[model samples]
Target: MKVKAIRVHKIGGPEVLTWEEVEIGEPSEGEIRIKNKAIGVNYVDIYYRTGLHQEPLPFVPGKEAVGVVSAVGPGVTGIEVGDVVGYADTPMGTYTEEQIIPATLAIPIPPSVDHITAASVLLKGMTTYVLVKQAFKIQAGHTVLVHAAAGGVGSLLCQWANALGATVIGTVSTQEKAIQAAEDGCHHVIIYTEEDFVAQVAEITSRKGVHVVYDAVGKDTFKGSMECLMPRGCMISYGQCSGRPDPVPVSDLASKSLILGRPGMRHYTATRDELLHAAGEVFAGVAAGVLRVRVNHVYPLHEAARAHADLEARRTSGSVVLLPAMPAADS
Candidate 1:
């Protein structure tokens, strides 16, 4: 079948994201074909578009989407045709109208969760689940500092950490984002554009600092994030949105008795069971109102380039999703 998709012929800017028709063959053994309803837009996609994260040329640059199973491959059981499913773990090629993915990676979306919500939260929420619950357990009374708290994953992290009975301190660029962060369950919000986040964190924590510092902004916040952590506290550096952080010196950790981890979803969801467990927790959180999935921007699938530009420019907040069913519009 020929389906519309955004293909990257070369790694460069958002303009490199080209919308074209591509052929998709039938699902092979242990694979399933999905007709995407909603596709997620994330910084990782931007990494793929540029040369930051290397991938083969002329490939689709999306890792997350929610869709319905159009066909099931031979020997695939438990997942049937017409099941509403979402996937974050991948073989790439998700920026399309339909995709063929491994059945093991396809997670069945609950009836209560809509396709938009699933696309918006599956990847981000699962990341938060592993970061707050698995990477560094956020116990009650713990204090956590989340950089980019108004961002897609950061917003969810703030809420989930707060729900765990931890004190959530978030850093955002604008006052508007500061307000949004507070509403998203942040106990304290720091406007990093005007204030020194490291100093603010110190003041908030009474000069002691937090139990854990989740720094996804990478290069820009890496050094400061270390300063915001208490002795023996963990620094979870999962992303490099600002740019890859400088290599940490072993002596630095020794000096502060600090722990640093750069974890990825692959490690957290190494098995199908682990993937389901993390995704299930995220879905449950959304259903129980413990976490809110916000879709702040929506675009037609072909407008992915514009979406990427907005994201890279920091013009968007909350989650952004692409509607594959909608027709492409002029830029």
Candidate 2:
């Protein structure tokens, strides 16, 4: 049978995202065919589309999606047909009406969580989980700085860290985003375009500096965010929306015994067990009201090109998900 999906033929602008029909054969052993309900649009997709990340061209480029099992192929038993599921796994084919995903990667969604919310949360929520729960382990009395506080991962990170009893300090480019970040439980916000976040962090921490800095803004905020960290503090440069962070001098690392490096949700949840554990924490947080998802935009799957345009143009405020041609009725 055939399915509709967004395909990128060559590296370029958002114009590269094209919706086309492609054949989808029955799933192989250990795989399951899914009828997509909703799909998440992440900044990483833009990086891939523009050749910044350099994936194979003429590809379907999406990582997170929510759907229902239409057919479970041979050797799959746990997830039966009609089961709702979501995933943050690879293969980059979620921008579609249907997909064949590995059974190992899909996680069953609870009845309380709708497909759109599940799709929206899978990638961003897991990123936040790894940032707070895995990397630095945000705990009581810790002050943390999150760059791009109004963006998808930042919005959730602020609230999650706050719930963990840490004071959340967010950096945003605009006054509106600053307000949004503040409202999302951020204890403080730095308008990075106007003020030096390093200075603000120093003032906020009484010159002691924060315990950790969660930086995804890359080149633009790397130096400043690092400067705001205390001795032996950890700096996680997880994403490079502004551009990849440059090499840091070994002397700088040794000078303050600073801990800094880049990491991703892929490594953090590499194994199926790890993925399940991370998803469990995320769902629990959402169920308990500790984490609130911010879905700011939803475009039809065919309009994925426009979605990418908005994301790359910095015209989006929060999470954006692409809805399938026929959205499922919440059950």
The whole-model lDDT of each prediction reads 0.93, 0.89
TM-score of each: 0.98, 0.96
Instruction: Give candidate 1's root-mean-square deviation (CA, Å).
Output: 2.1
Q: lDDT tens digits, residues 1-331, model 2?
A: 9888999999999888898999999989999999999999999988889998877778899999999899988999899999999878586878889999889999889899998899989889988898998877889999899999999999999999999899889999899999999988899999988998888889989999888999988998898888988898899898889997888887887877998867778898889899999999999999999888889999999999999988877788779999987456699
For TM-score, the strongest prediction is 1
- Candidate 1 local lDDT, 156-258, one digit each (tens): 9999999999999999999989999999999999999999998899998999989999998999999999998899999999889999999888899987799
Q: RMSD in Å for candidate 2, one decimal?
A: 2.2
